[model samples]
Target: MTFHYTRLANGLEILGESMPQSRSVAVGFFVQTGARNERPEEAGVSHFLEHMVFKGSERRTAWDVNRDFDAIGAHYNACTGEETTLYYAAVLPEYLFAALDILTDILRPSLRPEDFDTEKQVILEEIRMYEDQPAWSAYDEAVALFFGDHPLGHRILGTVESITALTRQQMLDYYRRRYLAGNIVVAVAGRLDWEATAAWLAEHCQHWPAGATPRRVTPVVSRPARKSVHRPQVNQEHMFLLTPAPPVESELRYAAEVLATILGDDTGSRLYWALIDTGRADSADMSYHEYQGAGAFFTYLCCEPADAAANLEITLETFRTAVRQGITEEEIRQAQSKLASRLVRGNERPQGRMRSLGYTWIYQHEYRSVDEELGRLRAVKREHLSQLLEQYNLLEPTIVALGPLAELAGTVFPAS
Candidate 1:
């Protein structure tokens, strides 16, 4: 295996990880703009634009775009998140250039008024669809509650009101501002020729303008609060406890991930034993989410309305115990092994390796092999977890709940 990196004169970065044994190649265009980059009035434009990118382009109709990928038997998709948007495809090594051409063409979308108007309804429908899910709706609200006025808390799928009023001009303006050459990374992995790939990108992307979009990186300050929404139509309760954690660039990120797995992995975890296996909750887990300059740790549970209070207490107790006593060496060892195994297995595939390569460069501007990542995971210790628990003030979290029972919001748990 070999890694390659190149930068065009216009500042576009092209990266490739060549795996001799792999039969498929994964290509991705990662844009450094998402929900957080939008102004208040342009809330969902990033995601809405993702949909429009597929609607049509100057050289290809929407049908042509879809049919062409199908012609090559490629698996392709795109998604938008809080901090980034990705367009990607996986194809046999022979179809690498075809896939790359199609992806690059769509990046310079026509953004036709007709296409924009048609996709507006689709985006609105998507927002309504997610609102119908109790867990999804609760988690979205929890992020807003936790982040307060921070732009990082903005919804990836804008609210119905924002989508309804957003205009095509606003989206076009945003595109021109954020979609500069320097703000994007083209990443590919698997069996490929790096020199040929780099030359292709350099020629095709020469016309793209060069400039980096600046991002606001205000430090997040979280406060303890509790809120609940009554969704009488839902049969189960969804709850989330959110607190700060190590950001993407932090050295403590490895320890934070291990701690989350030890406390809340789906099976053979502290949360599973106290909640799921005990039948106190239908689902329970703790996860760490990292963004460019900020991060969050989430503890989530779903249960019958009647068990909401009891389960909430149990979850709090689990966190308090870990904070007070720290975790056992055996638990740390198991978490390291579980995480290392996942890393190795995920990298075995070209698509997973492509994603890792893109995101690592986007966030850290460096590369780490599978061995280096496993080493980081294995380095986590009890003292590392202890430091994270104290440094992040993980014991105090903003709580959000959604269900048939409004009373659950008022239930209180003791602090660490």
Candidate 2:
């Protein structure tokens, strides 16, 4: 395996990880802009633009884009998130250049008025679909409550009103501002020659104008509160608890991940045994999400409306015990083993390796081998978990609950 990094004169970065033994190759375009980068009026434009990119480009029609990808037997998709957007494809090594060509063309979308008008309804429907899900609504509200006015709290899909009022010209303006050459990275992995890939990108991407939009990286100030929304259509109660954690750049990130897993992994976790096994909650888990300059630690639970209070109490007690007593060595060992297995297994595939390579450079501007990552996980000790629990004050979490029960709104769970 060989790793290569090149920065073109036009300011675009190309990252490649060569795995000679692999039969397939994966390529991705990582854009350093998302919901958090948008102004109030431009809400959802990043995601909307992601859809339009596939609708057509200056050089190819939407049908041609899809048909060409299909012709090469490629698997492709795109994602928009709070901090970034990505478009990626995986195909047999022999079709690498064909896949790269299609991927590149889509990035320069025409954003035609007719296509934009038609895609608006599709975006609205997508937003409505998520709104119908109780868990999704609850989490969305929880984010709003925790971050207050912070852009990190902005909804990726934006609100119905925002999308309905958005215009094609507005999206085109956003595209021109955020999709600059310096703001994007092209990552490729698997069977490929680094020299050839670099030369190809240099020639093809030379025409892209060079510039970058500066990201606003103010420290995230969290607002802690207890909020509840009454959703009559939901048969069960959904709860999301949020607290601040270390940012993605913190050295303690690996430890934070392990602690979350030990506390709320889907199975064989503190929450799983305390709530799920006892049937007090249908789903319970904890996740730590980190962005460029801020991060959030989340604990989620869903249960029958009648069992909401009891389940919440049990979940809190479990957290309290771990915080006060610290995690046992056995628990730490188990969490590390589980996480290590997942880390190594995930990177073994070309697609996964491509994503890892892209994200690492995007966030940290560094390359970390699978062994180096595993070492970080292995180095986490009980003391590290204890430090995170103390530093974050997980006891005073901002909570959001949604269900048929209205009384939960008035109920208070004090931080002890």
lDDT (Cα, tens digit) per residue for candidate 1, span 77-178? 999998889999999999999999999999999999998999999988999999988999999999999998899989999999999999999999999998
Clashes of each: 0, 0
Instruction: Return model 2's CA RMSD, one decimal.
Output: 1.1
| Stretches of model 1 off by over 4 angstroms after superposition | 409-413
CA lDDT of each prediction against the hidden true structure: 0.91, 0.90
Off by over 4 Å in 2: 409-413
Model 2 residue 100 CA deviation in Å: 0.8
Candidate 1 accuracy as lDDT: 0.91
What is the per-residue lDDT of model 2 for residues 1-416, given as tens digits with 9 covering 90 to 100? 88899998878999999998999999999999999999999799989999999998888989999999999999999999998899999999889899989988889999888999999999999999999999999999999999999999899999899999999889988989999999999999999988998998898898997998879799988866898798888899999999899999988899889989999999899999998999888999999999888888899999999889878877778778888788999999999999999998899899999999999998888988888889989999988888898888777789999999885733345566
